[model samples]
Target: MNESISDLTVRKHRGMWGWILISLLIAVIVLAVIGEIVVHRAMPILKGRVIETLSTRFNSRVEMEGFSVSVRKGLEVAGDGLRLYPQDEVVAAGATDPLITLGHFSFHASLSGLFVKPMHVGTVHVAGMAIHIPPREMRQQTPKGQRHLGKIKILVDEIVFDDSKLILGTIKPGKEPKDFELSRIVMRNVGPDAPWRYDATLVNAIPKGDIHAAGTFGPWNNESPGDSTVTGRYTFDHADLNTIKGIGGMLSSVGEFSGQLNRIVVDGTTETPDFSLDTANHPVPLHTKFHAIVDGTSGDTYLQPVEAQLGGSEFTCSGAVVNVKGKGHIIDLDVNVPAGRIQDFLQVAVKTTPVVMTGRLRMKTKLHIRPGPESVSKKIGLKGGFTLEQIHFTNPEVEDKVDMLSLRAQGDPKAAKPGAEDVHSEMVGEFVMDAGRLRFSKLNYSLPGADVMLAGEYTLDGERFEFEGKVRTKAKVSQMVASRWKSILLKPVDPFFKKDGAGAVIPVKVSGTKSAPKFGLDLHH
Candidate 1:
């Protein structure tokens, strides 16, 4: 009886152990199935949710392929590829119509935060990104009450673009549509949060050149609208200057350039943003700094009241606003050219000519123009002084090889106009030389045809000039003057000549404006 009871207890214990083992196996299988479902099905839905959230934030279409999620330890979401498109519609500031119509675009992201809320991005890579800005159509329909719509900002960790095209349109008068295309491009952001902290390189881009840029963006705050700053260095290698001559050519004289933007600040609440371009080793080497304030609330086109100092040359200009016609706003400007050497003046005047001189000159002028029009001034008022210590003409034909003359003059520097207000002006000045000599290799004064030696001090004013001092002539000079006068004019034109008909210097005076300055010789024996 005792043996039978013990056997029964043993059997019961064995049965309990078997049941426990079987339950453990069943739990394992269920958990495996659930894991498979989460990886194959639930993960993709979560990815779609992520894409939806980002699309809402950026106001653009987003998509991903081969998306997968991990849930063993932490939440990890990734995809083979992803993309994003430009917002369906974008309107530039101050424009009532949409300017950009984009196509579908995409990108990829590695997401984290399976256990935590507000998922974090471990690594986000964007690929096959292509954006299109459709050409402006005359009859296209746009959303009502929309001042402007477009991609104001784009954030991505890595982006790759292939065979991209862009079209720009001008509704204003006298402008043609423009387009740009690119073959391949690759861009990457180093930091995750500061996505604009980026390095991008483009090859076979429009304007025919390769471009490379790196910079950072954001930390936006309303208190300081310019708090969002971007600093980057870029190089445009082997670009065609003539292609963009209509725009950038006005400021620089280079076809190829590499430089850096040390700092660019855009204030959200301000009307103007401040920026600087550092151009080094370019053909022109332009270093310009600018400041502007823009109104954030109102989408009024902000014009940068540009005040720049270029290579010791300062310019103060305002009212560069853009008009409704898509043209630059006209502004009244004042420019002061400080006293500098004639060499510097020549550099600013004619770049190709090597005609060199040593002198100082100052000129003040006013400029008037409407935005988008060529710089044109209705009237230029100039009052300045120039002294040519030694004016030398390099042309060998002239007899005066070296001119040790000093000149001072001031006048309005505007060309004369017909049937308009008097655009002409006068200047009063003098040219003086002490103990100077001129050797004219060939000098033929039409009236006398004499090889003459001239030396004196002269005072000049509107249409009049006077020379007081001695003028000497060579021995043959007298005979030649007589012969030339007889040949040219049967009757002697001047009564100052004596019966001997000798060549001699008398009191001389010249008076005239630049257009009709006259020369007079007073021969008092």
Candidate 2:
């Protein structure tokens, strides 16, 4: 009876202990469920903080569509459809779209850091971010000493963007805004009050090139985004100038820039090994170093000065490349060459293999080129004057004829044999180029014993030359013949040819192709 009683007592004690343990397990499960509910309810507070931070930074209103938080691995926060609008006045005026829009964004942070006044976060990954900056006049400046009642400040270690876009709004009534497509962007130490270090890659719309840049961009100026500061260095490679229709080249450049967002000062150098005009199709090496001011909003460039080299010739140019409403970019430049070679200019402008003339040259001209599909020679316009000294025709036959003419004009008919001597000429002209031809209004040519004044046109293709001129020589008509009998017979007509205080004055014409030029007397004129 005693053994049975002991066994029943032990069974009762064991059953009681098992029930207590089960009750404790159920309580713990209920507590965990309650805690989860509280966390879900408190997520709105975190969302509000994010909105408040952005609103205070931009002095605008912020809105979000969805928000979620995950503590499974070190506090991950994510959201979609975030937008920021302009201040009260702009909102009241009924703007169509928000100033900034983000499709989706996410970031990681320590759970303890999320509850702090100034939150510190890890790298933020953003996708499909678009910034639409309004015209300067449409925005309002923030008050000088305004303080936020409950501002939530956030400091980010870095921010990364896989795809983003920037649009600059214009003040012109019907003009479209400028757009820049950014492929990738990374910013470090991003905060509201300090500049952020950034590296970016983007496409250049006009020339169709790749640009990689590293820089520092502002603590933004919400009132006038153009007034925000920016500084950077960039490398632009494989820019195809053929995109402009009339020109062709593969250009490369490296540069540095600094200033406000709208107007930036840049110093750079460019090199193009095979730069060529479509009309000529003869490539020449071109290089330049320039100092310019660029208007980011309008895509205009104002060149203070550009030092350029084409083959062996050097010149300086200053001008503006501006965008027109209906047309594309127009180039207007003032060009000056203190000293150059005529052959170098011809090599790039003319289609002939060997240039017709060689000389030391000086020139000043105004150059204007409008964008078009026509040949560059047909589209380019130039108004200028040039001086050539010690000029010589490149063809041996032509040079020999010029040398014979000089010898005969100096009253030495026996010495007028070709291949016996060489002669150089001087020329000065005021010219205008249009439709692939050069028109000279005033042209003067001089040699050792003769002077000529002429006016005419020359085609750029070297296909035609038509010039009429009056040539005066030191020798009389009787002295120009080698035979004694011919000289005596011509004496009677010497007085008829004498004019302008010269022994002989003749009306002459130069007409023919470059290879076989003809010089003859034009008595009909």
Candidate 3:
């Protein structure tokens, strides 16, 4: 009887625990169904809250047609015919265009809100959008620390624009705005603590051209996008320069820059290598290396040190280039070359040298280029001088004549070949350019057999030259010429203008095309 009682009590305890477990399971199921109903009802309210918050925070008019909530996507929102405008702008009369237009937009919430630590926006996809940013001065302003967007305490991790157009007003007054269109651009890591990275191909809307860039931006604030820093590299290959206003011709350039934009002023250092400048006369572009401190505020780029290689010569140049809006451009540069070959002149200059020349050239040049057309180069103003020293002549006839004269004092005929006479002169000249012509003054050529002094004018574009001068010949050069019956031809004229100098002085006139010059020696100038 005692054993039967113990077994019945154990069975009763097991039956009681099983009933309790069943009751707990039923309660859990009921709660889950109720929770689902509540969430379904709350979604509509959640959508309104999002719309109100965004509209109030951005200080813009906002609306949405579709909204929902999901465990995976968090709060999902989509809409068409979306437009965002500043509050005052909508109230203002005659507003031409809204600041931004959104044909279709989508937004999803970040799941990290459960952790509630760092603020992150999952993503914002803006499709078929257009943004028109007006000129800096004309743009509407909200007092600092007072803008609704600035007051918001949320961070956005990413924003994307799909098939969007961006219109940016010029910093310069009276200049037209610039237009760029992009397809599905992605901008990520856009919080204050993180750097924003982006990649996109942008097309010029009006004058069609394309440029591609991939870069990082930092210190970005949502309210004031212009007040940010950028570190990036850009390349435009075989692009039309006219696509950007105020710049013309064809450009194929690559450059890198690191700068911050404060309002409309951009301050930074920039460098471009193998930049080609093409224009009307020059079908083949001229390549240059540009390194400078760029200042957008002052409308000037100051190049402390710049370099270029044209022909076989290397030039060190420094200057300031300024754009004067309606007046075009102003360029002031100082150019210097330490060592240059004279025969190399034909490689760069418009003229073909008359003689084979080898020399070391030193010059101090100040050149100013004004705004104009293709003739701008010819019309540039230049004030400078050059010294040609250690010059060698490869012409055999000229060398032999000058050598024989040099040997006159030594009375050496065996040295007639004039191997040592291959070179013997130092030529110097100072020039001033006005209009399209250069006037040469204080020009002197000191040679072994003769010294020639000249003054002349040369038309740069026409490649024409005219000069009047006197050549004073020494013992051998004068005696060699006087021995000819040609002396009889000048006997009547020699006495009228004859001069007692180092030897005989002859009046000469130089007139010809630079490519094929002519020297006339006669009593008449």
Q: Which candidate is the best by TM-score?
A: 2
The stretch of ten residues in a row with the least summed lDDT in candidate 2 is 139-148
lDDT of 1 at 385: 29
The 10 consecutive residues of candidate 1 with the worst lDDT sum are 404-413
Candidate 2 on 118-211: residue-level lDDT in tens?
Answer: 8888798999998887665555443444444558566778999878888766666534466789888999988787889999998787578988
Ranking by lDDT: 2, 3, 1
Displacement of residue 223 (Cα, Å) in model 1 is 15
lDDT of each: 0.36, 0.82, 0.59
Candidate 1, position 368, lDDT: 45
Q: List the residue pairs that clash in candidate 2.
A: none
Model 1: lDDT to the true structure: 0.36
Candidate 3 per-residue C-alpha lDDT over 179-239 given as tens digits, one digit per residue, 9 for 90 to 100: 4577667788765546689876677542355667678866643344334566666666666
Candidate 1 segments exceeding 4 Å error = 1-44, 55-122, 127-196, 201-211, 219-229, 233-240, 244-335, 341-358, 366-390, 396-525
What are the TM-scores, per candidate, against the unseen true structure?
0.40, 0.86, 0.62
RMSD of each: 15.7, 4.8, 9.7
Pairs clashing within candidate 3: none
TM-score of 1: 0.40
